[model samples]
Target chain A: MTLSTMRFTEAHEWLRPDEEDPTVVTVGITSHAAEQLGDVVFVELPEPPATVAKDDEVAVIESVKAASEILAPVDGEVLEVNEALADNPGQASEDPMGEGWFFTMKIADPDALAALMTEAAYKAHIGE
Target chain B: MAADLDAARATPLTGMLAELGGKMVSYADHALPVQFAGVMAEHTHTRTAASLFDVSHMGQVTVRGPGAAEALEALIPANLIGLAEGRQRYGLLTNSAGGIEDDLMAARLGPDHFVLVVNGACRDADFALLKAGLPGLEVSMAEDRALIALQGPKAEAALSALWPEAAEMRFMDVREAVVDGISVLVARAGYTGEDGYEISVSAQDATRLAKLLLAQQDVLPAGLGARDSLRLEAGLPLMGNDMGPDVSPAQAGLGWGIPKIRRTGGARAGGFPGADAILAEFENGAARSRVGLRPVGRAPMRAGIVLFADQEGGTPVGEIQSGGFGPTVGGPIAMGRVDAARAQPGTTLYGEMRGKRLPVEVVPLPFTPAQYKR
Candidate 1:
């Protein structure tokens, strides 16, 4: 879909700038990460209002096979979390880039968005 | 994930697996499928239907000679002498220090004849030890065969369609049978704690038989991920993870496998490798013990999580050995060691994870009840 408008991180997290709010971005793992994780059984999202530094372990998701950490892509404050993940974590795998968004964040610098990988660049980075 | 097959060993079904959407992972130096469909789906399918698993990576050894039974009994803890032909028993190979070397399934094929299925990781060491221990017996690796397991509630119905006698077989029964003219060693036993059969057939026929089983109604191909989760949920202690060369059998809740005849005061007592320390522990008790762990919340606690008696103080009392999400339990489940004094079921213990002490409960093993066709 509109994945061309989103940015991706090496950790497989994707970020989409909020259409209504340029300072805010919606974040979730990419479809690639979700596929690699098999079946998602549990997801622990960061608490809202929490300030995280770049690369900080801000969330955790447990698949039936293993537990993996979802790190912060940039310094930001957690604006809101996806509470729907608690009841049906499989959504993370079923619709990773859309309804499966983990949280919404307000980053310290909107200019940092330029540092993320464009979808086409990410495809090559993952050897697609 | 794709495994680097350059230096990895491949099972008879390895190539077929790669073509069947099986995700590969390198384990025990072998390039094996870690998951085919997905862990949760395969796991739930096995509980409700039938799932086929390629377990050929495990070592298959056959021992023969008039004294084979007695020789093996002296090396492991089990009443092998009393084990009837066409039956199998779970056994533990203990070191002289009373720690478990490995756990295995021993089947009495005939008088003085036995077949052993051992852990893949410990196959070489187990073979070497058995060879050295049973000096005069015919201990040889049956590498020509491939091991595949069909597990689940519908396993009987699925297998019976091919081998009509399968419906008559009970739990732990091992017998020779013909499946559409392909002779196989069928054992009504599996790690999933479900009614199922583990079939050992010639390596050349492995893929053919697996495909046949998968073609059966409700039978899907599962991989190592579901295998591990199913076994953990069944309260089975994995050799390297939950029980190992450092964990005593008694401490691992495996004392029941050692028959009374092998104990301190029995007909053939105190003869095994660690008989002294083992019997002593039977009389006394292990300082620490294995217990099923249930992480407090939805967050899954994992291996290497340090255990503390208090939420935020003192030295670590224990550590989690095997931890993962149990799909059957519908939550995260784990197995770990804790101080013996506080190892009772329902006791609360704290595990340190990510700079925070998380609470977990000590519970009885086998988070789910076994559904064996006994």
Candidate 2:
């Protein structure tokens, strides 16, 4: 259930290199986050091109049971949003690292990327 | 409300426990809710493979009397009299005003004995309702039994490997099977619209039975999270969410359960409380019918989202009652009550969510086609 290619933030957000645009890091919810939220019914993604600060809320996932916020990983302008999520929030679970990738960011602080958890570290941290 | 269930949890089977490294939350107060692995995965796995669900929290009650089936038929809509020995039926107990008392499954074990599986949250109230409605029948709340559903196309294969005789039973049938000498009542029925069996066993034997099933190659442990999503994807209605007292069976699209034989005038057959209102709905089309909805964008259309004729406010047409992202369909889907005129398949609509009107469409239900093993 762990995606080794993705880096995790303590806040439960995950980021990875965007295949369509390698320099852009795609951000999304981690599998653990989706599991915790249970049945996700609604999701709202910030519009693409919106400038965002690190830790800013970028998306919302609502379940019949609970609602959660998805935060940003870096201070940058949003390049594109996963519009598909607006219709299928379960994407957060099915392909959290790929098609479910929330948004892409042009790194404002490439050095901050060093602060994220390595695949092994996140697995251990979440006790996966 | 929780205190009521807390009292019932004093029994061994009702004590909540977390299994398989899954996280647990307070679901219906007494039961531990497994929210991990996602509802979609747990649900889809149960349909194509085998899933172990900790339904130990559901209420299992036995009613016995010379007229048990007749007593139950007088309260619920299912044709209990016609139910063959060792068969089950999904039924609804309703009040005189046409309000649902509770949705339950009743099984006939012998000529004058039956078992009722009721919703976890509604257990206490259902017991009270049954007692008041059928004063002559003896009802025994089997609080010591745990229920586990082993469901999917691979369910029979996996279960039969352990107890080969179960593979031959058809849908809605029940039989007594023993695994490692622990007795179980296996019923070929489930809420997820999948081919499965709901196995009832003593609480002390639940963990052992579950472990045995999970050890099998095809079985996976799923939680309530997946149970809800799977049932939604199959277009099945959840009692509290999709159909409550405010909603009638006709409006919820469950009119087919009413038998035509019951409609005839003679001895009046069953004396169900809501017979008049339900029969009227059957004769005359319902004012509002439940319809399947698909939003146009990637964001999900959720409950309370107002249904409008168009994005520019042609007029409020209806509202979403239940909505979710269907993992199997890979999109957002929902059920809503709308004007009969606007309920046709492929009709365009809009869902008002958070001050924004999103484009949507009216689609035929079962968002994803059901794969029930008939």
> Which of the CAPRI classes, incorrect, acceptable, medium or high, describes model 1?
high
What is the alpha-carbon interface RMSD for each candidate?
Answer: 1.0, 3.4
lDDT per residue (tens digit) for residues B219-260 in model 2: 887777678767777888777877777777778777655665
Worst 10 residues of 2 chain A by lDDT: A33-42
Model 1 chain B: weakest 10-residue lDDT segment is B1-10
For model 1, residues B55-91, the per-residue Cα lDDT tens digits are 9888999999998889999998899999999999999
The recovered share of true contacts, given per candidate in order, is 0.90, 0.43
**What's every prediction's RMSD, in angstroms?**
1.4, 5.3
Count of clashes, each model:
0, 8
Docking class of predicted structure 2: acceptable
lDDT over C-alpha atoms for residue A122 of model 1: 95
lDDT of 2 by residue, A1-128 (tens): 34565678988888886566545787887777766666666677888888889888777777645567778887888898888877666676667666877888887877677778977888788998
lDDT of 1: 0.90
